[model samples]
Target chain A: TQLLEQSPQFLSIQEGENLTVYCNSSSVFSSLQWYRQEPGEGPVLLVTVVTGGEVKKLKRLTFQFGDARKDSSLHITAAQTGDTGLYLCAQTFYGGSQGNLIFGKGTKLSVKP
Target chain B: EAGVAQSPRYKIIEKRQSVAFWCNPISGHATLYWYQQILGQGPKLLIQFQNNGVVDDSQLPKDRFSAERLKGVDSTLKIQPAKLEDSAVYLCASRQWTSGGPGGNEQFFGPGTRLTVL
Candidate 1:
């Protein structure tokens, strides 16, 4: 079984504080995706990282994929209340017959103003 | 374009009761997915349909949980004799299948139906 372990299951921080969440796996993955889900809603895709040691940024959010393809991280700079949500990391199967996604338990973040 | 739509935003029932949820995928999306999310956990895939055909349903509890996507547009999931563990949010998602297959495409999600089994 391919398992994705996420650290700091819950986080609460004041506005303007920065935080970083991690997703680690024992198995290597071809592609990994980050998603954020708010209360009463399903998760929404934030980004997908496929290359080793790759870094991508979206506004104040930054995503990094480990060189070994066994870990990924999400960093939020100057967090705001709007940034509060459950952050999930998922391994996406590419070019496979099923091509399904396996997700981590997720990290719940709360940014208080 | 409209996103995936799910009905019955919330439902509460006693254990052993039966319930059904509906979903309408976005237009032109060939793949539809059903997921169950427990509290403090990420969503887990229950079933996958590719244009009205079942692509995968390995994790589904076939004895009590059943789902169908008729006409390749709308879908329904039914659970019989629900247990307390069945309490969770049911989410519907849709994705457009491209030549590259399921890779790289974003799966749009619905607001989800919260089910409570008392």
Candidate 2:
């Protein structure tokens, strides 16, 4: 089974602090996506990186795809209380002509005021 | 445009009970997905449908879990004889399919249905 391992399972940081979450895997993916989910709600797409070594910025968040396409990272600068949530990384796995996403366990981040 | 919609925000039932959840994707979205998200974990895809056709259901537990997307727009997921491990959030998502298969599309998610199996 292809698994995405996420680092720092739980994070509690003060507001304005910077934090980074990592997702690593042995298998390569065609594309990687990052999502943030609040309690009682489903995940919302933050950004998607398709090419190796690609980087995308959305406001205060910066997402980077690994050069080998086997890993990805999400960095938050000056995080606010609103940024506290569960962050997940997912990628499409082509298993026998079937394309479905395999997701990481996720990192739970808490940005305290 | 409206986001995906799901009914019964929360449900609590004993083990071995049966339950079903409904979902309505955003209008015109040709691709729909059902996922199960256990606490402290990311959402896992249980099934995927492309305009009323099954695309993938490799991870779904066929014995107790079943889902269908009829008419290519709305869908339902049912869990019969639920186990304690079945307690989790059931999320429904949909995406607009373009000429290029399943890549490069942003999926919109609905507020999940939280099920608690005792």
Candidate 3:
């Protein structure tokens, strides 16, 4: 079974602080996706990084896939309180056809105003 | 376009009781998925359906849990004789089947049904 390891399981920071979370795995993936989830709601897709060394930005959020496809990272710039939520990284293995995602434990972010 | 829909946003039942949750996938989406998410954890895939046929159900606890996607449009998940450990949020997601893609399909998620077994 493939497992994703997420770093800094929990984070608390004041508004305007910048932070980064990471997801790593020994197995290579065909693609990686990032999601943000708030309390009482299901996770929403943020972005999907398919190519190695790819970077996509959604306003204040920046996501990157590693060159080797074994790791990914999410960076938030000047975060606001609205950014407070759970961040998760999911991977589609090299040969998975059903599109079933293997997810990391996730990083819980708390931004204080 | 409407996103995925789920019924009974919250359900509280006693241990050993049975409970069910419903989900309506987005129109034109051929694939559907059910996931169980414990607090402070990522969602775990319980089952996947391609139309009315099940594609994968490897992670589901078959002894107590059962799910069906009838007509390939709507689905229901049931747990009989629920246990305290069964308490968690059940999320339903759907995605359109594209011929090919570099990344894979993007899934649209529903609000999820929170289940608590006392």
Please give the distance, in angstroms, between residue A6's alpha carbon in candidate 2 and its true position after superposition: 0.8
Q: Tell me the DockQ of each model, to 2 decimals.
A: 0.60, 0.57, 0.65
Q: Rank the candidates by DockQ, best first.
A: 3, 1, 2
lDDT of 3 at A82: 96
Docking class of 1: medium
> Number of backbone collisions per candidate, in order?
0, 0, 0
In the range A1-113, model 3's lDDT, one tens digit per residue, is: 68999988999999999999999999887788999999988889999998989999999999999999899999999999999999999986434445888789899999999
User: What is the C-alpha local distance difference test score of candidate 1?
Assistant: 0.91
DockQ of 3: 0.65
Minimum summed lDDT over a 10-residue window in model 2 chain A is located at A92-101
lDDT of each: 0.91, 0.89, 0.90
User: Model 2, stretches more than 4 Å misplaced?
Assistant: A94-99, B98-103
> Candidate 2 on B50-112: residue-level lDDT in tens?
999988898899999999987999999999989999999999998787324435678889999
Rank candidates by lDDT, best first: 1, 3, 2
Candidates 1 and 2 compared: the better one by TM-score is 1
Q: For residue A85, give model 2's deviation from the true position in Å.
A: 0.4
For candidate 3, lDDT tens digit of each residue in B1-118? 9999999999999999999999999999999999999887899999989899898898999999999998989999999989999999999999897335557778889999999999
- Which ranges in model 1 have alpha carbons more than 4 Å from their true place? A95-97, B98-103
Let me know the DockQ for model 1.
0.60
